[model samples]
Target: MIKQTFTSLAFLCFALITFNVNAQDFKDLDKSPMDAASFPTSNRVTEKVVKVIYSRPQLKGRMVESLTPHGKVWRTGANEATSITFYKDVTFGSTPVKAGTYSLFTIPGEKEWTFIINSDVDVWGAYSYNKNNDVARATGTVTEGNKSLEVFSIAFDKDGAMHLGWGTVRVSVPIK
Candidate 1:
């Protein structure tokens, strides 16, 4: 019993010391923080039709076009590719998509943006984006927002339209 007690005490002391040493390394915060957007748009609502998880990247004195770029597939957010989960089958823009989780990708254009719901999940970025894994593709109108946003954001409006905004650029797609 004495030997076991000493071993336990020593292990506890080592764990506490190791944890104290490692705690200092976690001082920095993620530059691009993760955020979520759900349909219903209210905390009071228990049920949700859709939800999106993504990281918000700040502009920080950078141009939106230069960061996202036109005619290229963007991850839709920073870090891991943006993921959207649907509770039920719904019409996304003009395309029908089943209830499931998917990685959201975007191809930005001058007048419109092509939003792709891909079966690929847990992707780091658009680097491994595959066209064959696309579940559905939809087009969203690109417009200029009245106010500029420093960080990339996503929200669902009251009309069930998903909006993506960053800098002065806004893109909208209807979901029903």
Candidate 2:
């Protein structure tokens, strides 16, 4: 009985210490993530359509090419693979994609960016990117925006073209 009591006390102390350490870790996160969505809100007449769930990574002190090197696949956001869901069949450029969920990835380049839709879902990052699982590929026109963007953002326009902006680089891909 004495041995069991001593063991229980020790376990309780260890658990308390572990909990305290984990609780303090949340404060270290500089950029708290957010989930952004497309479509109308409030009294807008446009019905809901596409949506994206991703972490908004900020450009605190990082360069665009340094963060997303040329010729390499970018998850598009901070954590977890960027998810793009389509409520209806849409033509991404000239390629038609069915209404479903897919992993959104991009290859940032100096001239243009290549938008990718992969069949593989629920992936963590570009580490699991496979060309074999790619469903569609579209070229996005990269242009310089008038304003400097601090955080990486993905938003869709009224014409169903989704735009991605980070720092000074902006790219758009038509989804309708």
Point to the candidate with the largest TM-score.
1
Model 2 TM-score, 2 decimals: 0.80
Writing each residue's lDDT as its tens digit, candidate 1 over 1-176 gives 99999999999999999998998787679999999999999999979999999999999999999998899999998999999999999999889999999999999988999999999999999999999999988999899999999999999999789999999999989999
Where does model 2 exceed 4 Å of error?
Answer: 1-32, 40-47
In lDDT terms, which candidate is top? 1
Q: What TM-score, computed on C-alpha atoms, does each candidate reach?
A: 0.88, 0.80
Candidate 2 per-residue lDDT over residues 1-176, each given as its tens digit:
99999999999999999999998886555473867767543237555667788888888888877888999999988778899887888788789999899999999999899999998889988999999999999999889999988889888787878899989899999877
Candidate 2, residue 126: lDDT: 93
Q: Which residue runs does candidate 1 get wrong by more than 4 Å? A: 1-25
